[model samples]
Target: RVRAYVPYGKQWYPYFMRRLAERPANVAFLLRNLLRS
Candidate 1:
């Protein structure tokens, strides 16, 4: 079993991006989103 907790607030996206920037795999995910936009 696995569980995750998510936080909700106005600042969530920046904080989330900061976290994703720390990992290489997540960088690809982030770039894909940027290109899509």
Candidate 2:
């Protein structure tokens, strides 16, 4: 399953940080793909 969130305002930062903390591998995956481009 896939999920998406669109947070408005300054609070988006904390929400994104919490998500990265919870799924650390996602950070690595994102970096990998970013570098590949």
Best by TM-score: 2
Off by over 4 Å in 1: 28-37
lDDT of 1 at 9: 100
lDDT of 1 at 23: 87
Evaluated against the true structure, the overall lDDT of model 1 is 0.83
Instruction: Give candidate 2's root-mean-square deviation (CA, Å).
Output: 2.3
Estimate the lDDT of model 2.
Answer: 0.89
RMSD of each: 4.1, 2.3
In candidate 2, the residue pairs with backbone N, CA or C atoms under 3 Å apart (3 or more residues apart, or in different chains) clash, namely none
lDDT of 1 by residue, 1-37 (tens): 9988575699888888788778879889868999999
RMSD (CA, Å), candidate 1 to true, equals 4.1
lDDT of 2 at 22: 99
